[model samples]
Target: MNPRATPTAPPAPGPDSLTERYVHAVTRRLPEDQRDDVARELRATVADRADSLHDAGATDDEAERAAVTELGDPDRLAADYRGSAQQLIGPALYPAWARMLRILLLVVVPIVVVVVTVVDLLDGADAGSLIGGAVTTALGVGVQLAFWVTLVYALLDRTLSRAEAEQACGGPWSPDDLPPVRTSRGSVGDLAASLAFYALVAGALVWQQLRPPVDGHPLIDPALWSFWIPVLLVALAGEAAYEVWKWRTGWTRRTALLNLVPTTLFALPLAYLAWSERLLDPDAVAAIQQGWPDFDPGVAHLVVLAVCVVVWVWDVVDGFRRAA
Candidate 1:
């Protein structure tokens, strides 16, 4: 073809123009290839919106300008569209997993919270104590929400992308993303938290066994003491977080695992606490004895608790490696 055969192109829209400006604003927030895809989607949405306005009596140019104005500044809109909320709800709300989470939280959390609050009140807790407890509860919930919402949605987006690509390429989820099954191991902080948690559970079990019983039967606190579990769990989690910081490493997974180790350890005691409080199971946990000959379940429990502590420490450290 001749060099002068093709007509010259028109100059691009001015910086002042609305549609061009809007597209430019949000596109930069997206992935390179997906940038164009999002831009096109936005464009289509704008065009359709503008067309509807025109049909409702606005002039064509006025409608287009209105759509552009509705989009607002490039930076804010771009940042919001690229945020974690979009990946979580704007994208996943329709997914089965997302719906299940909504149902579980909506139905379960308030009931549990109310019951716990009532139990706390009946235990002769003062107004000042309840107010302080509420504040602490709110803060703990906010932290967990901040962590899980961001991480899970990001993970979900990544997973979906991989799944889509695999469908196109005839592949499966990659092994690299899956952590290897290996022996558990952990850091100093993890060891401390695990040891502390187990030591505490062990201590609690021992204290119960040693406490003098009423009429040869163990005495129980009957006002539904299971409400204390969340407060206790939060305290343990904070300890785990401190341990993660203490064992600072190049291995992020180890830190995360250390974090989870506390959660698991906390759960065991929390479970035992619930059982003791609700079912009033006296024989469930027993004190450790130097000499044991008969079928002593307490011995088995003590062994399990000890094993959990050791594995928890290792788990915390190896969680750093991520191949654990």
Candidate 2:
């Protein structure tokens, strides 16, 4: 039997009134297990307040409205109930800390991984060794990033006055400053997945160089390593940073336009390389010819070009669509 499906007594009915609406707003933000109890307690408190006001000669409607107003914004009240008001970083610095940590993790971690992987690749390490080294380095870097960022924020929280902290965090928060309900545009999971995908791509680019050589040449042309490959790697890093910024700021028309820079930087050069038949080693091409004898490199180039164009267009379009 499903635990969630287990039978339980229904909640006692409350009046369909202003207090009910206020209670619902507060309790809805609470954990499911706590909601019923919190809702009941909140309703009782509101009733008592309203009763006192009514006894002081206010009408029922006025008393109820005043009681609810006295409780303040339901969202803020919910935060208090959840004990979010207390923290190592405190409320003022917590938001800034979280945002900075997210940016650092998203932007810095992947770059560190890619750089470590590339360095290991250049050092002539085997694929397994390089991959393991990259993973270990990434973990170390991540821990350091988290530790330092937290320490700095904790120091700031301790050192700054409340007014200073509030100013640094973009002033004291208000009901008007409450964020809208979240949408799917800037999901952390999605950003992580994208970074992981780029890391895999970087790994693949490095691994291809270590493949069994055809006439002492890897599958990818070594000549392009001087410029094209390095530029591509830099572009990939830029793309990763862009993903982090997008996740931090969410989609917007300006960001959508900015997205084109890294997308084109990656796609156009790759397409050009593939189209000009410089992407793959000539010996590798010859080996393919020897095996199949009918392999047309032009067809391969066109396929690559088409794929690049399609992916580039789709990414740009999706950004604008999400922003909208």
Candidate 3:
């Protein structure tokens, strides 16, 4: 009789099986230099685990599924093997990243869209062009904001130590940092009003130049159109952007300090112009004098300067009060 042939171990699962697919998923994410070794090791480990399960009375298909399931998500496993983080911004920096992104989207994006729309409207663009310009501006600004914000946070996540990252994200949270709860509807209305006021201010600045002149002179000094008027408009735009940020973030000492920048930009220039008697066009002033003989230019200048001082002080005070 022929010698009895010893039964050899069963061959490992085929390439198309669940175990092979799982191995592929994991190795694909790994570096090319590490892929071959990792794939071989992973495949052998999975096959052995599956075989043991099968011996324990699981069917071949059930064993293969169980082996892969026990390994968890392939993306996570790949990250483990590479010794890298699984997130763009880790938990330490995520809150700051999220808050910054919200502020940018809520503030910068709308400002960009509105500016583009207004420019297009002033150019007498057709309705289609106006809508398209606004939409495109919004999308472009949003994409830029997201990419840059993510890249910055990702770099910080990789390069900074944990303590450094926490500090960079404004340090550990405290009860004092918590914002006072306010009605959401009221906040929304306030934001809307602030935005609208800025829009009107911007529109008025441009409209003054476009409107028919009174007595051969614009209401504002024509010389101002060369520099100071544009500066004022830019300052107003900055204020508008800050207003949106403040609305979202609520008040803080830092924000209050920042508020002084745009306020000074606007008020200082006006005050200087008023004090030097260069604010109104001489022709416009003459026309006004003709209508009201008792109008005093000196009194008007003083009144304008006083109003600027009062408004600037009130705004600065209000910001700190809200923060407190």
After TM-score superposition, the amount by which residue 266's alpha carbon in candidate 1 deviates from its true location, in angstroms, is 10
Can you give the TM-score per candidate against the true fold?
0.31, 0.48, 0.67
Error of 2 at 278 (Å): 1.0
RMSD of each: 15.4, 18.8, 6.5
Order of all candidates by TM-score, from best down to worst? 3, 2, 1
Alpha carbon lDDT of residue 255, candidate 2? 70
Per-residue error for 68 in candidate 2, Å, reads: 61
Candidate 3 lDDT, tens digit per residue, 1-324?
Answer: 744332332567787988789999999989999999999999877877777787778987888799899999998999999999878888988899998898678767865676566667767899999998888888999999999999999999999989999889778777877654543322878888987997798887778767836766677787887678767776777788888777766787877887898788889998988888888777788888898988887788889899988999999999888767
lDDT of 1 at 303: 59
Model 3 residue 77 CA deviation in Å: 1.7
Scored by Cα lDDT, where does model 3 land?
A: 0.81
- Please name the candidate that would achieve the greatest lDDT relative to the true structure: 3
List candidate 2 stretches off by more than 4 Å: 1-121, 124-185, 213-217
Against the unseen true structure, what C-alpha lDDT does each candidate score?
A: 0.53, 0.81, 0.81
Report the error of model 2 at residue 180, Å. 6.8
